[model samples]
Target: MRTAYGVETVRATERQLMARLPEGTLMQRAAAGLAVASADLLGRVYGSRVVLLVGSGDNGGDALYAGARLARRGAGVTALLLAPERAHAGGLAALRRAGGTTVHSPAGGRAAGATEGAADRPAGGSASDPAERPAGGPAGPTAAEVLIERADLVLDGIVGIGGKGGLRPDAARLAEAAERSRAAVIAVDLPSGVDADTGQVHGAAIRADLTVTFGTHKPGLLIDPARDFAGTVRLVDIGLDLPEEPALEALQHADVARLLPVPGPESDKYRRGVVGIAAGSARYPGAAVLAVAGALHGGAGAVRYVGPAGDAVLARFPETLVSDLGPAKAGRVQSWVVGPGAGDDAATVAQVLEADVPVLIDADGLRLADRDTVRARTALTLMTPHAGEAAALLGVARAEVEGARLSAVRELAARYRATVLLKGSTTLVAAEEGAVRVNATGTSWLATAGSGDVLSGLAGSLLAAGLPARDAGSVAAYLHGLAGRYAADGAPVGAQDVAKAIARAWRDVRD
Candidate 1:
């Protein structure tokens, strides 16, 4: 499992570690790692031009120290200080000592890079100073913008993790310039202007090609919106003694493999467990077929499907035990998956809710299932909803749920007193407590029609096989995502195609 700590926990851990170590030791450690990552990105640093968007915080220090390291390696490094008066004094000294010049932008005007060791140089150097500008360089663009535009690499240190509500206007301009530039942008710790704890990007933020995080993974680095801004993430261990419990956890292949249910030789079909899928109305029969298709590969011994679409399901999967009876009389099913094109069948949703076995609610079930009944259930309940369904349940706008997925999933899980799997660009499974599991295997290709139906059946089967709600949801999402990848292979694919690819995903996980 890849774990991520909340900002408070990370800060607390950093404080404790810093108290024991020599002053500035921790920053140096972070700087060394940042420099290494920066150097690796600037392959052949000898002639590379590196630009640092320096802020007033420790992040700026990290960039400055890293810039010094690059400067020492024969890279032409320039620091564009957003707040020159408040820049890290030690870092500025280090950069100057390493032969890197600083460009201070005051009032958003053009400024030339100050000459090294020029004690009397104005805050913004004269544009006529040939020492800073390239000989006869284009005159219109600010020196800061020119430096950013022409650099081989740009380090975003405009804001730190603690800063919120997006970047200041001046800093925003630098970020915009970096985005327009051809240089590969590297953000220190995480992309600036994203909420570290919630993965929310409120306004203008840095979009980096790579984010070098220190000590531990921030919640923002793993979740979306903010996660999208952060390109590839690289974790550098600065040796802070973090707590065991993480705010968020992402299951890797090994973790998913361990959680997957594998039957023993003595196990019979009945012993393997049966999943009951109470879904599909006459209006939408394909939903049933797709659900059953996914359930068949979901480690369950058998699938008992009860709905109006029995004939449609039987036509595709003859192995499914189809019945017209309601979910209550669907025989002895270990678990039940309700909804998925169910169309307003509130009574059936209630019947499955009344059952003692674990239940998974998805699609129309999210709308039909009563909240109080779900909250009162003694058995484990897993509710899978895309952003829209989740928004309806919470009575909030879909955009709100999409922007703050971590909080929305957790809130839904708490309100329903059930586990929730919020599906989108990044799928998340959250219970009332413990670390929220984020599914990273998902692809945008899985956004096709009936995709959630397939996920519902797979997770329901896992529940029937006796996996806890969290584990069932997490494992199902992992396999479903991998299956989507296999089915699509970078092309458009149907939900059935994704369901058909589950077996390959299962085998791949075990191996």
Candidate 2:
């Protein structure tokens, strides 16, 4: 599992490391990694023109040191100091020693060329002056635009962890110029102007093609909004011994494979696990068929269907055992999946909830639930709510859930004391333990009518197969997303096709 920590945790870890290590040690490690990554971006560092957007803090210091490294290797490096005097003194000297040139803003009248040992020329230079030289002026768009457009790469050192949300006016203008240029942008630590902890973009943020983060991953780089701005994240180990407060996490393929339920050789059909599904009605019998289809493909040994659509399920699946009684009387089942197209059938939902087995509530079932009754249930419960359904459950607007998806999912889980899966562009699974996982698979084409119903049934089957409630929810999401991508293959696919694709997805995972 890949873990991400909040800004506070990162800061504390950095402080601890700084107290134990030599002065400037961590910054040197960060600068070295930044230089190597920059070289990769430029393909050939030698003779490459590089521009550094120097700010007033350690962020600018990091960029200056990195520019010095590149300059020593024969690259033409220019540092556009947003705050020349306030910049890191040690870093400035290092850059000068490496033959890096510095240009002050036009507002600060040109001083003697310290490193070159020559008197400073006038701003924009006279006609006799070399055309390759930089003429800094106010460090605004015009100056940054010219430098960025001419360089092969632009290193964004505008703001670091010390800064707050959004860019300062000067930094924003420089970022905009960098965006318009052809150069590949590299952000130090993170894309500037984004909230490191919350992943919220206060105003405009620099979009980097590559971000070289130090020590560990930040929560903003893993979650949305801010994550969208951070292109490809690369962590540089700065030797900080961190604690275990991870704000977010993403599951890799190996983690999913480990969580998947694989039946043992001694396991019989009954021991493998059985899933009972309470779904469909006379008005929407296809919902039952689709739900049962997903359960059959999902790792369950047998699926028992109970509802008005029993006939429809049996007609489609043939193998599913149909029962007239509700889920509570559906004989024996390891897990129960309630509500798909059941409409507002409170009686069926109540009966399903009364079952002794693990239960997964979805769709119309989420609407029929009483908060007290759901909270009182002793069995492990998994609630799968799309943004709209989640909005209704939380008594908040749908737009609110969509805006802060991570918080919404966690709130649902904590309030109900269950595992909550918030489905959307990024499927989020939250548990009562405050653990959350983001599913980064699936295509937009999976947005069919009954797709969610299929997911509900698949999760229920996984629960029956002996996976814990949280693992079942997350694994089902992974498989469902992979299956959706497979079924679509760049074309539109219906709900039934998605259900059929689950088998292929399971096989792929096993292989």
Candidate 3:
């Protein structure tokens, strides 16, 4: 599992490490890593042009020092100081000594890169949108514009992890220009203008080709919105002893492989656990078919399906044991999966809730199940809801739930006394307490019809196999995401394709 820490914890750890080292030892260590990462991206550094968007913090100092290293290695490096008076004194002098120059980008300075009465120089491209071609400044091309246009690399040090409230106007403009430029933008630590603790991005933020973070991964680097801005993240160890508990965690292949339930010599169909799938209706038999399709591949020994779509399910997967009766008469099952497309079947949902087995509720079940009764259940209850369903359960707007997905999942899990899985661009599984697991796998193509139904059956089977509510939900999501990726190798795919790919994903993880 990959773990990520929040801002306060990261800061405390850094302070301790800094105290033991020399005055600038930690900074130098970080600078060395940053410089190395930058050099690798630049490839041929001899005549490469590098631009550093310097701010008023150690983040900027790290960039300046790294720029000095590049200058020494025969690269033309320039520092665009957003605040010259507050810039790191040591770093500024080091740059000058290494034949690099610094220019103050005062708020009201002419758009053109000029020295007033000083020597005339070309300007880099004035800040603009990253997606467009480099547009010349109003007064033709300025020195700043020219530098940015010709630069092979740009380092973003505008805001550090400690900063708050999104981007200031000037910072936003520069970030936009850097992104618009042809250079590969590299962010120091986390991306600028992002909430390091919450993974929230507001106003304008730097979109880097890569982010060189120090010591450990920050929460923002792992979560979305901010995570989207942080293209690819590379962690550099500056040697800080961190705590075991992280603000967030992501399961890797090894973690999932260990949790997978494999058949053994002593195991029989009954010993392996039977998953009871109560889904679909007269109107939508496809929901039952898709759900059963997923269950067959989810490590379950047998699936006892009780619903209106028995004929459709048996047609696609004859392995499924179909019954026309309700969940109460579905015989014995280790776990029950209620909802999916059982539209208006409040009575069926109520019956499954009383089954005394771990139950996974999704789709219509989320809408039909009584909140008070669900909370009263003794066994593990896993609720999988997309943003819309989750919002209704929490009695809030969909936007509210989506804006703070981490908080929403936790809140729903705590209130309902169940494990909650919020599915979206960034799928999260949260228990009533502890750190949430952010799904590391998936493709946008997974957002098709009946996809959630497929996920419900897979997760329910894991629950039947004796995985706890949290593990079952998270593991299912991880495999589901990988399956989505495999099924849609860049093209659109249906729920059946994702279901078919689940076995491939499971085996790939084991191998």
Instruction: Tell me, by lDDT, which candidate is best.
Output: 1
Candidate scoring better on lDDT of 1 and 2: 1
Better of 1 and 3 by TM-score: 1
User: What is the Cα-based TM-score of model 3?
Assistant: 0.92
Q: Highest TM-score among the candidates is held by which one?
A: 1
lDDT, candidate 2, 1-511, per-residue tens? 7787777787778777777877888788999999999998899999999998876666677898999999999999887776565556667777878988776533232111111110111112212213223454443456647878888988987677645657756567678878888989999998887767666677777899999998888877766667777889999998878777578777777888888777899987678789999999999898889889889888889999999998888878999989997676678999999989989899989888877779999999999977788888888899999999999999999977875777888899999998999898678889888888877678899999999989988999999998888889989999999999999999999988998998888788777
What digit string (tens of lDDT, one per residue) describes model 3 on residues 451-484?
Answer: 9989999999999999999899989999999999
lDDT of 1 by residue, 310-395 (tens): 99998899999987778877788999999998998888999989999999999999999999999999999999999999999999
What TM-score against the true fold does each predicted structure earn? 0.94, 0.87, 0.92
Candidate 2: regions farther than 4 A off: 103-141
Ranked candidates, highest TM-score first: 1, 3, 2
Clash pairs detected, candidate 1: none
Order of all candidates by lDDT, from best down to worst?
1, 3, 2
